[model samples]
Target: MDKELTSSIEKVRSAVKEELTHYLAEQRDYLTSIASELIPVCDALEDYLLEGGKRLRPLFAYAGFMAAGATPTRTDIRAMASLELLQACALIHDDLMDGSDTRRGKPAIHRHFESLHRQGSMSGVPEQFGAAAAVLLGDLALVWSDHMLHNAGLSHESLMAALRIHDEMRIELMAGQYLDVREAGEKEFSVERSLRIARYKSGKYTIERPLHLGAVIASPAQSEHGQLLNVLSAYGLPLGEAFQLRDDLLGIFGDPTVTGKPAGDDLREGKRTVLMAMTLEKASAPARRELQRDLGNPTLTVQRIEELRTIITETGAVAEVEKLIEGLATESKIAAQSSAIAADAQPFLLALADSAIRRSH
Candidate 1:
């Protein structure tokens, strides 16, 4: 990305962080007023939200709003910032479901609470206590997402309009998550099925729906609405898929220091990603047996992970996923150049696509 685009992205990120800080402070005050015992919950949320994140969802939403030929107010930016809370909800639950130990180099929410339980000598299973806390925190984040958007100071019309898209996005996300968990439990894996899960789980809400949320908030005239959305979808959907594919590759091959997770964490989690599906298709019987034996083994050794990495590369799945990412990125860029996109917004959208595909974590 050029300096200008990079600067714009940073500016958006800063603004969203500011809004989140302000909103969380208000909520913190409210929670403390209700009871001092809620301090840990508030503290954890603050650390998770403010510490580090790409803020991609808000950035996409801002780009989408800009594409509608409308300037954004601070309030508009606050509404965009709300997406981060929703993302947090998803991630906290995801870590719990995947039995992840850490996130961004810190204990996962469930693990955090579990440690709290142990330290407090609280009765009952620490693990179960941790799981319950994580579930409640995730639910709190979901509720806060709605509250932030509703109070974001958009006009009634825009809020109503945005809510429709918001509701749809949430529903789609839940459905996608269900598919992801279901696919993991199945004995058979298909590249086609895995791709479908990717589309729903990580693709749509991450990119397409955020863009649509912004576009809808712009409140375009009825006649322009359908066409504008269609055009944005052309750009967002493929790019979203590409983004998720990049994530999948990183899950297996990424540097632990940069990704803030153990190497081959996705393998240990038994993620049924498209790359894994493709590997199974191309691997020899012996290689397939090796993979099936230890793919989801949490106790897997570093040497074993390296061996699995070699097996996957030898199957040519890594190269194929790279090719797919490149193709989808090209398609997104081409769609971004359409006349339907606001000229000012087009550059940022293109830049966002490049960033999405190129991120290390």
Candidate 2:
């Protein structure tokens, strides 16, 4: 399943790339090529947008299109590319909101602004202004993404569906972010609690909406949509949740160099993720105390981080969570295989389910 889905996604990537390039060459053109002041900023934004990502949402949208036997067209490609732009907008804002310094091996947008402000002997610039600029830049990308979707030359129904999905994604993700921020300071973390956060924060918005958007674009009729939506939800929900769980594990244990960020960033942020919840669930009282004391403390030493890791492991939480992810992946695969969805989509759905539990980042 993973191999087949990966092949299809790779095939769709050409469309995504072409659309992004066209957006730069055409829509981003200056009034005066050499004399224009906005060209540099536009170029910088283009570079930033093209920097790095898995292009997962766009791939999902394309896969759904193919599953529904929609002919590949320029409009389809353009519509799909807008998903990536929407994702980029979300990431830029997410990084700023998290105050993250890096993403995909380079400085995040705000950090980039800050660095540019500090470079070439530029001084006396307030660092807060950099973050402010990034916020506005993200807002621009968000609006641009919506515009791209709207002008994709699709049927009014399809365009409306796409726009609705985009709007719902933004709102739901913000709600999830609020939940995340609220949960970080709590002590009584549970598996159910963490799962609730995962569903809101990543599962539905990340997987379901993209699938539905494409499904609607490809086959918006009521008679056709119910089955497709159900299959996609079945295939995406558990996989999305497991994906976030794996990411949570990686947050604490992954190599910072490979992850392209500081290790223990999630810990410092005190994310109330399933792994952390499980640690407390499986640990003894004193172990919980140690975890609470050192887990999120930025000033904690390396020794303390290691100790926290050991305690988490000793409680058997990590192993338990790993098994749960495997279970969820299997469940997704089963759902994909049994779903009364389009025959063309089954293979891709199964492959996505199988691969969701295997990603390293």
Candidate 3:
């Protein structure tokens, strides 16, 4: 089963990657005549888009195209590229907001430009100026993504729906961020609060909206359309929750070398995660106090993180969460199997169901 999934994903991934590369090359030429200054900005956009991991939004979009019984035309390809551009924009802004130095094992675009500035070379752009420049670059990608989508061969109605999805994704993500910030400051973080943060912030944007946006683009015709959307929601939300849960575990416990970030990042950042809330709720008094005191400390150490892990285990949160993750995966598979989504899409959908909860990073 795993082998078949790996093979299928590789084929889909190859197609998606080719489409992205073709789009980037076309974009590079388009921007070249504008200015030498614009060349570097275009280069940066191409770099990150080409270098990203997963391309999950585009993947979901691809699956949608398949489910609609359409081979990807130029328009479908453009939509796929647009999704990645939007994701790139979000990541740039997110890294800056989080004060994140690296993304997927490389210096983030802003920091990379900042380094070039600090080197005291030819042009003498200030480091802060470079960061500002990167911010503008991200904004351009965000705007351009919309432009590409608007120009794609979608009906005006379908395009509007996609735009609405884009708007909603942005608002929900921002709200989720604020919720996390506020929750971190609260004396007692609840399990319910943590789940809400995951759903609004990471889950909805990552899974739910992407899947639905694809459905909108496919524009199914019949009573089955509503049912297909509902099925996707039922599958995506839980899978998203599990994805975040695994992320919470990795945030504190995963290897920094593999994850491309410092260990204990979430612990130091003091994220009010679902895992933490669940652990807190179930843990003994002393264990709870230990978590409360240690969770957000900027000076947290590996040894302390290990101790926290021990305490969480003693509370059975890990076991409980794992069980829930399995249940969600099972449910996602069941939903996908029963859905009216095209038969050809089943393997891809099932692949996602299998992978959604099992990935470590």
Candidate 4:
């Protein structure tokens, strides 16, 4: 990573944390007597938001603003920080849906609530209570994301422009997630479908939309807005796909300590990622049957995971995915270099693309 880009990302991280702290504190005071029980919900939200994350959305947003030749202000930072809340909502709901036990190496929100219910001897079913709480918490986070963005002091026109991208991003994310969950249970695999899932679920929301939001903010009235958006898409779309591909690799093979999730979690969840789809397409009959049997089995042992890993490797899926990532990465770099984005911002954008695909976690 470029030292300058790294420093800029760190600065965005710090700014987001500060903005989140202030917002949560205000909410805490506002809800103090209205419903004291909700206090813990806020606490959980804070912990989840502040605990551990790369804050990639906001950094990308900032880069987008810079790419559009706009200097950032505190209000811009606050508005950009809202992306983290949106992400929190997505993760909370995703964990609940997946029945995941942990996130960031800690008990997921629903599991945390389940433990609380059990510890307190609460009347209802702990599992149901946990699921319900997680759903509501996730909704709250989504709402708060809107609130933060609305209150960030952008002109009404700017807010509205940004909201268009924001709304589309959310819609695409939900639609993509639905497809992902639906495809997981199907026996057949399709590379095309998997790529579509990646494009919507992580790609656009993770990079393209953020960059567009910033570009809109900076040049809502500029004649070249369309061109800038196209340029950003040129870079963001491919990089986003590469990002998800890297994540697919990490879900299976990454160190738990570094990834903050259990090894082979994706296999347990039967994630229908491109890597899995491609592997399925090429594997021998026996290997395919074994994979189908154990892919989503919750009780897969460590030895079984190792066997699956060997199968994936032997089938040449890993190499193929790596080759794809490299190609997409190169494509993104070319787009970034050739785009009419501000020269001063090109290096940061390129650095971000490199970091996104090359990261271990």
Q: For this target, which candidate reaches the highest lDDT against the unseen true structure?
A: 1
Candidate 2, residue 76: lDDT: 78
Whole-model Cα lDDT per candidate? 0.92, 0.75, 0.74, 0.89
Error of 4 at 202 (Å): 1.5
The window of 10 residues in a row where model 2 has the poorest summed lDDT is: 31-40
Screening candidate 2 with a backbone cut-off below 3 angstroms (N, C-alpha, C), the clashing residue pairs are 1-351, 2-351
- Give me the runs in candidate 3 sitting further than 4 Å from their true place: 30-32, 68-71, 121-127, 155-161, 220-225
Best by TM-score: 1
> Which runs of model 2 end up more than 4 angstroms from their true locations?
1-5, 30-40, 120-124, 185-188, 223-225, 299-303
- Estimate TM-scores for all models: 0.98, 0.90, 0.88, 0.97
Instruction: Write the number of the candidate with greater lDDT, choosing between 2 and 3.
Output: 2
Please write out the lDDT profile of model 2 over residues 61-144, one tens digit for every residue: 765665565655789778878877777777888888777888877878888878777773465674775788788878877877
For model 1, how does the per-residue alpha-carbon lDDT over 253-357 read when each residue is reduced to its tens digit? 999999999999988877899999999999999999989888888988888889899999999999999999999999999989989888999999999999999
Better of 1 and 3 by lDDT: 1
What is the TM-score of candidate 4?
0.97
Q: Candidate 3: which pairs clash?
A: none
Candidate 4, residues 84-151: lDDT per residue as tens digits?
99999999999998999999999999999999899989898999999999999999999999999999
